[model samples]
Target: MTNQGFPRGLRILTAGEYRHVFEHASFRIHGKGLLALATPNDLGHVRVGLVFSKKNVRRAVDRNRLKRLTRESVRLRQQWLPSVDIVVLSRKGVHEIDSETLARQLHGMWRRLEKDVKRQPEHQQ
Candidate 1:
């Protein structure tokens, strides 16, 4: 898993890591059917976590599809992203959208998250 892919190192692997982002996120970038909460991290690269509930996506297949779409989007955009931890939450209607649209939405959220986080004061960074 190089920097070019979604390596283990780039994932928010533990409950505590996810908790920190949820508790202290400085930027909340919302997209259609998605919400991304992000905060600066001490690590020198971006990390991501997904929260696609079965209650929202309804089926295991749909949930897996959403996760795949999100991970693929994150993997493709990770290089230029600022060092931060992000938790992405999915809404009920996510399964209705096509993969391309969902990917575009996720990409836009990442771009916005990158811009907003970089613009924050040094303390937040």
Candidate 2:
């Protein structure tokens, strides 16, 4: 099978999109310096957004690295994820962790979110 790229439709773009997921999150997980917020979407596919503030990562290089790792983690697990909009927020001390550790945290977070999404009522989720 051919692999399609991570297009705009598969991403939570724009401030409004981010705000919606943040304000109306149906599930959340806090692991290490990662805070994952998820809300069901009508698009019938999983979309992810990354939030790496200067206060958290300090350096632009670090922020970009975290973002890349987070994206890779999400992409690898998207097939099993529920149709939801997810936003991963980086907190203080996130810059200290390496990509492998960060990826592990993200994996755990996604598993937690999958459980939460499945537990929700048919109408709500």
CA lDDT of each prediction against the hidden true structure? 0.88, 0.88
Q: Across residues 35-57, which tens digit of lDDT does each residue of candidate 2 receive?
A: 98889998888999999999878
The weakest ten consecutive residues by lDDT in model 1 span 1-10
Model 1 stretches with alpha carbons more than 4 Å out: none
- For candidate 1, write residues 41-62 as lDDT tens digits: 8888989999999888898988
Pairs with backbone N, CA or C atoms under 3 Å apart (clashes), candidate 1: none
What would the TM-score be for candidate 2 when compared with the true structure? 0.94
Q: In model 2, how large is the Cα lDDT of residue 52?
A: 93
User: How much is 105 displaced in model 2, in angstroms?
Assistant: 1.1
